[model samples]
Target chain A: MIPASFDYVRATSLSHAIGLLQDDPDGNKLVAGGHTLIPTLKLRLASPALLIDISGIDELRGIEVADCIRIGALTTHAELLASKPLREVLPIFHQAADMIADPQVRNRGTIGGSLANADPAADWPAVVIALKGELELAGPTRRRRIAARDFFVDIMTTALEPGEVLVAIHMPRPNRGAKFRYRKIRHPASGYAVVGVAATLCLRDDIVSEVMIAITGATSRAFAADSASTHLIGKPLSTENIAMAASLTGEQAECLSDHYASADYRKHLVKTEVSRALASLNGA
Target chain B: MTDHTEELHVVTVDVNGVRRTASVEARKLLVHLLRDDLGLTGTHVGCDTSQCGACTVDIDGQAVKSCTVLAVMTSGSSITTIEGLARGGGALHPVQAAFHEHHALQCGFCTPGMIMSVRQMLGQNPNPTESEIRHGLAGNICRCTGYNNIVRAVQSLASEAPRHD
Candidate 1:
């Protein structure tokens, strides 16, 4: 399907993209990787007057590890899966990236684009929210940070303002004794998560010191299961405790229902997926 | 609904090691550019929607669905279609030879994409297990062969003498 014709300009720099978006009276869209925007354009879901191509912008293209792991917005899923630093530091990213679509899609999809697109079933939101990551946003004048938990406003919506661009994602270095896992029941056709759960656990002397559980695909937006995560704190990683925590996965969530899966089925999947992820962590 | 002829973009891309330049609408997909404009019809468009990997091609050393990528997005990228897999037009690439030997394709509609995907996979991992090959080929689907022989074709290449370019 051909998208509606639109003027395209390749941005020369980060500021250039922001300037182009700010100056366009008819509204402009930024495309990196074009995995999400191009599809939306083809379906006529979006028709911006101008497309600011930021895929070639050097400022949005690398993975750097300082105090926190900073991933450029344009980092592709394939690149994330292949990073030796990410594998050593945050293997949960690998678990999620490997489950995202296939190699061809991964080669062209960008983390920033995925997060900004904010698909309800996207894997990055669950993982990022579970890890308590932060996103850096740039605009025509200023820059600021938004926590992953606050980033997603609703399905296909984000906290980004007009003329703002997501520059990078910052994830804190994993705490010592940190163990994390992401589990999903993927749609057979699109490879999107039917019900995805990301769990991050910290154990001190066999007792849970810190725990965070985030669920996706079950709700309109991916969010941390606060009540369920709180239930794991100061408890041993026992089957009974895990079961109790998993049961609370969708207690506060407004689960989504569609032709693919019913709300009841998604809720059931939340429990099952959380239990499975916790079990994998327990076995590890 | 207004006329958008002004949105035409002049894209210069190196396809199969040869430079090809054309003026296309900014919304034209890479697959259409390769097949319609360049006349390199070896890259088939099974599904225009990026779901089927039939339009798989190597763009700057990565295998991507051409249907999902705009031709303007690859202004200076070096793309390799299935036609570029052979050397000197004489000997087939090991992947092609293996597919031919193992009868990997049945109807041959998905051959070009399958071959392109396998070449990229082998370029990354010269030796891959059966499970790895299956995972690598997940993007490319073939309804006829049931993937039994396709997996064998990739495995055969992995077991052969590593080809150095």
Candidate 2:
């Protein structure tokens, strides 16, 4: 379906994009990579009078690492998959990028766009929540950093205010001697996760020291599986503990019913995928 | 006129080594610009949604769903379509030749998207394993040929010719 008619404004710079949005009282929307928003617009799920295309903005399009790996909002999945730095230093980014929608979707979809859309089925949100990432948002007034945990409020909702644009995503340096793994049950058509789990653990002689687990696609928003993580922490990697943690995730997660799958099925998937994710971590 | 100049919306883009300039609505999809405005009909539109990659085109050296990209988004970018796959003198692209030689297409409904995707796959990884080829073409779905011949065509190109898409 064609999107409703709307005026398009080209933002030559970051400030120009902000200006366009600030001028619109009803609020102008930023279009970067338009992989998600465009579809939403087409379905009339969202209707913004003015669309400020920020894909042309040069500032938001690269991956840099100093104290942390900072990814520009416009960085495409295809670019992430081909990034030598990300592959060498943080392989999980590439692994997550590989599982996103199809190749065509990845080529045009942006990290910032997905984060801003906050689709529960999106894979990146799960990764960000697990890594304790920070989002750098630029608004007409000021810039603020929102924790990935707090950034996502619910499905199709975020902590973003009007006239604010997600500028970049900041991921802390991976802890040394840390083992990480993520697994997902992807929706066959859209490649969206039916259930996804991202787990990072600092293992000391096969016992969990620092464990962080984030669950996505099983609820309205990406959430930390605190109960599950607590179960794994200070415990040896064994089948018994893994089963206990997986069970805790089922109890802690707020599953939703949808046409694609039922709430019960999602719970079951959360249980199975968490177990599998833990197993992969142990094997690695 | 609201004191705002009616800025010239002229865009000159390089498509298939030929330059194209047209004044278009800001809301026009790139597929419309290429097919209706520039008369490049080889890029077919199967579904308006981005799900079907039938409207696939190479934009700025990357394969993207043309149906979702605005024409203005690609104002200065280079594009490659099915018509541009062959050489100026009628030499078919290696991937296209392989598809024809292997009978990879039946109804040809999804030929353009399949061909464009194959071009990108071979360009990215000239020699992809069988499983890699399957994953690579996972985005491009085909009802006919059952994907067996398509896989063979890509595999054949990967092994023997050493040609880039």
Candidate 3:
């Protein structure tokens, strides 16, 4: 499938890339790691007049821990899988990266690109939402920080404005007693989540101090499993509380009905995955 | 649509250790530029959508799906295709040799992508477990072989001399 004709510009730097977008009246699209955008372009779903290639900008590719563990927007999934710091500090992220599409896709796909694409079935959204990460955006005028909960507006949409690029993601290290888990029902072909859950619990003496549960794949955007989270917090690690929390899996998120899975099936997954994730926490 | 406002630009990148330049349509994909313009058909295009990993290539020491990358994006970078894997005098890379020796391939349509993927897998971790091999090759789908010998081929190649250099 040949893509439709469009202009191409390899941006030399971050400012140049943003400037390219700001100046273009006909609308230009940013291409970083192109796994998401290129496929859409090839399908003729999007035909922009200008494509600002930002993947060449080296400043946007890394993961380092400073005040917060910062993940550069252009950090490839393969890079994350290979990062020793990520493996040591946050092994769960590495696990999710391992489960992403395949080696080739991981080699080219970027975390920033994935977040910006905002695929509801994507794994990062659930993790990011559950972790309460911050997305730093470099827009034409200024840089701003958006919470993961606010960043995703809908399926395939984000809070990014025109001429804005997601620079990096910020994840502060989890506090002591933090227990985390990520579970997903993977689509056989794309390896995307049919329904995914990321659970983080801070347990103090067998009672939950803080709990965060994020649901993806069953909704237009990942969201807090508030009902489930509320049910588990301040409660003992028991079957009753776990069940109460697991039942809140997709209460808020609208389930999608498609040829792949019915809405009922996805709702069932929401319940089952939440329960399984909770069970793992209890076993641990 | 007659009055155009923008000018298409030309960019050059090193491919297979050879300096190749092409005056391409601004929207041309790197895979198309490699196969159509430069006539490097060894880099097959099974899925232009980037799902199949058939157009895998190494850009600046990293395996990337060529179909999703723009030719203009690779300017000033070195690219290695399946053609570049075998060096002077046609000495097969250990991975390529292992693939043949293990009969890892069947239809051979996905051979180039599969071979490239194995190189990436072994390059990152010299000794990957069988499960790691399966997970690594998941991006490069092969309807043939059921992936048994391909995993063996990668397992064998991982123990051999590094495919690079």
Candidate 4:
């Protein structure tokens, strides 16, 4: 399926790309790995008049596991899977990347594009939300960061403003004692998450100090399971508490239904996956 | 600063051992560029949507579905298709030889892509177990619905002394 005709420009730098989008944001779109954009174009879901290719911009690529974790928007899924330091600091990233499509897709798919695309079933949003990450956006005149929890607005939509390019993802390095896990039921064909649940729990003296439970692919958007997180905080990380926390995620939102899965089934999977993910973090 | 003026762009890719160039429209996919322009037809297009790995190729030492990439985007990268897998002396690439020895192909339509993906899979993990090889082959699908022999072929190559090729 050949995509619709469009002019393409390889942007030289971050500012150059944002400036290009500023000219005609509606008619122009940014292309990093083109894993999602190309498919969207081929499906004729979008036919931008211009594509500002940011793949060559060297500044937007890397995984830095410093005091604060900073991931350049253009870092590929393969890069994430290969980063020994990133795996050591936040192995949840490796878990998420491992469950993504196949090796070939991972080689070309960028985490920035995945998050910016905001596919409800995309694993990055849930993981980022659980990790308490922030997204850095660059526009023609200014730059700002938005929390991942609030960045995703709806299906295939994000808080990204017109002419603003997602430049990087930021997260405070997780607490040394925090437990991280991402568990998902992958759709057999697409390898997309049927329902993905990510858990990041920090235990202090056997009580939850910080906890986040985020669910994806079950609702109109990836969302933090706030009720579940609230239930887990200030509580022991027991199997019973985990099960109760997971149960709250089922009714957290009215799940969306498609030919692949019904609303009830997805809701059920959300609760099940949340329980499974959180329970895994209880002891180890 | 990028030139947003032109509709046609020039791309140069080193395919196999040869550097090939083409001036193509921005919408032209890399698969079309290879199959239509350079005539490296071994990279099949089983599904153009990037799901099916029939169009798999090595781009900068990574397996990528050509259908998903714009030809113009890979301006100076090195790409290798099944046609490029053989050694300089025309001996079959170990992957191809393995497949041949294992009788891995049923219909042979997905053979090229499978071989290419396996090459990259092994490159990343020189010694992969059966489960690992199966995991790595998640991108390629045999319409014939058989992967036993293909897995065996990869197992044979993986168990051999790691080759630099």
* Best model per TM-score: 1
TM-score of chain B of 4: 0.90
Q: How well does each candidate superpose onto the true structure, as a TM-score? A: 0.97, 0.95, 0.93, 0.96
B1-165 per-residue lDDT for model 4 (tens digits): 233344678898898889888999999999999999998898999978788899999998999999999999999999888888784659898999999999999889899999989998888788887788888999998978489999889988875653432
In candidate 3, the residue pairs with backbone N, CA or C atoms under 3 Å apart (3 or more residues apart, or in different chains) clash, namely none
Which stretches of candidate 4 lie above 4 Å from their native place? B1-6, B87-89, B160-165
DockQ of each: 0.68, 0.43, 0.54, 0.55
Query: Per-residue lDDT of B1-165 in model 3, one digit per residue for the tens?
Result: 222344556768898899988776766789889999899999988866777878889888877788888787777889999999886649898888999999998889889988888887777788888777777777787888998998878877666553432
In model 1, the runs with Cα more than 4 Å from the true position are: A24-26, B1-3, B160-165
Per-residue error for A59 in candidate 2, Å, reads 2.2
Write down the TM-score for model 2.
Answer: 0.95
Candidate order by TM-score, highest to lowest? Answer: 1, 4, 2, 3
Instruction: List native contact recovery per candidate, as a fraction of 1.
Output: 0.75, 0.46, 0.71, 0.84
**Candidate 2 chain A: 10-residue stretch with minimal lDDT:** A1-10
Quality of candidate 1 docking, DockQ: 0.68
Query: What does candidate 2's lDDT look like per residue over A146-213, in tens digits?
Result: 99999999888999988888899998888777777778999887788999998888888888998888
Worst 10 residues of 4 chain A by lDDT: A275-284
Give lDDT tens digits, candidate 1, residues A78-154.
Answer: 99999988888889889999999999999999999999889999999999999999999999889999999999989
Q: What is the lDDT of residue B2 in candidate 1?
A: 41
